[model samples]
Target: MDTGVAIFPTHDAIAPADVARLAEQRGHESLFFPEHTHIPASRATPWPGGRPLPRRYAHTFDLFVAVTAAVTATTRLRVGSGVCLVIQRDPIITAKEVASVDVLSGGRFEFGVGAGWNREEMANHGTDPRVRMAIMRERVEAMKAIWTSEEASYAGSHVSFDRIWSWPKPAQRPHPPVLVGGDGPGVLDRVLAFGDAWIPNHAPAGILERAKELRARADRAVGLIVMGVPADPRVLEAYAAAGFARAVHWLPSAQRGPVERAFDAFEAAVAEFTGE
Candidate 1:
């Protein structure tokens, strides 16, 4: 299995270009950054970890900008949004961003997407939390049309546009790989429907069983990328044995020296686990 890294690039953290170069030099396969447009200061939604939200969530750099910096700094390291909240973005604009990165990066981009959990946050974007799944699906479908067709159009309850021309068609023929994020019930269904990969947080239990089940399907093929993985050799071995294609180690937002030290540690763990 291949190893990658994920970070929430913040104003105070190591610059993304440096992170990308270091990750490439250390022999990592990919770099992923996640998005949070803005976190509401007060919300009824409790953080899943039962603690205050991390500072990084409130301070993250824009996903596209971070990914662009990383990809431009390194030629071979794949860059992605660990989970771009599709329900909260304008699909047409996002389609252009994805294609631009893919084209400029020589086809090395992965599109990881999710229906986010913050109700008030989504409300701020004019997205209803209750229908986020449907909206996310429609948006992704619409974006796919925009990417693959010369004069593409989509008509959906949430997103619709007339025939439109979009340029810089992605270097990857059918656009960058869409890795659907989340292991909630029916998430695999979404992956099979329109996504090129299945990405789930490596925690919250039962994911191992789900991964095994997904891998058992012989008729369909999908990439599997597990996010927020622990840098444990045993866990890495288990993931590879369970048929995971990639595992992303979490990189906490921090100043350059500390963060680079953490990368070195993770790199050593990866090398040991992969016998490289």
Candidate 2:
């Protein structure tokens, strides 16, 4: 399996250009940055990690801007939204951003998208949390239409646009690979419906089973990339054995020294696992 790294893009974290150069120089396949528009001070939605929400969640750089920085700093390394909250963005503007990045990056971009988990945050964007999944799916579909059609248009409950002209279509023929993020009960349905791949933040064993199940349900082989992975040879071995395509190690959002130290460890672990 190929190895990649993900980080929270925060104001005080290591600059994204540096992160991209580090990944490219180290021979990592990709770098991903997660997004959060804003974290409501008060909330009813509990963090999935079960601890107090991390400081990085409340202080993130704009997702596309960070991604653009990373991609521009390196020619070989692919950059992505660890999970761009589709439920919170306008499809038209987002489509333009995606296409612009892909065109400028020579197609070195992966579009990893999710509906997101923060209730108050989504609400702040005028998204109803309950129906956010449908909104996300429609937004993705709308973006795809924008990318692939000459006169793009979409009609859906959440997003609708009549034939409009958009320019600088993605460098990638059909656009960047849309990797669906999240592993909820109906996640596979969404993946088959609109995504090019699946990125699940799960343990290796759980991922193996889910990958098998997803492939069994689909007509063609479904791609799998496990995210939020630890720096461990054993975990990577499990993923590789299961024929998963990639393993993304999570790096804490921090200054250059500390974050690069963590990257060294993850790089070592991947080398060890692959016997390279």
Q: Which candidate tops TM-score? A: 2
RMSD of 2: 1.1
- Tell me each candidate's TM-score: 0.97, 0.97
What are the per-residue Cα lDDT tens digits for candidate 2 across 54-150? 8889888999999989988999998998899989999999999999999999999899999889999999999999999899999999999999999
lDDT of 1 at 16: 93
Taken over the whole model, the C-alpha lDDT of each candidate is 0.89, 0.90
Q: Compared with the true structure, what per-residue lDDT tens digits does model 1 show for residues 143-186?
A: 99999999999999999999999998999988899999987898
For candidate 1, what is the TM-score?
Answer: 0.97
lDDT minimum window of 10 residues, candidate 2? 202-211
Clashes of 1: 0
Clashes per candidate, residues 3 or more apart or on different chains: 0, 0
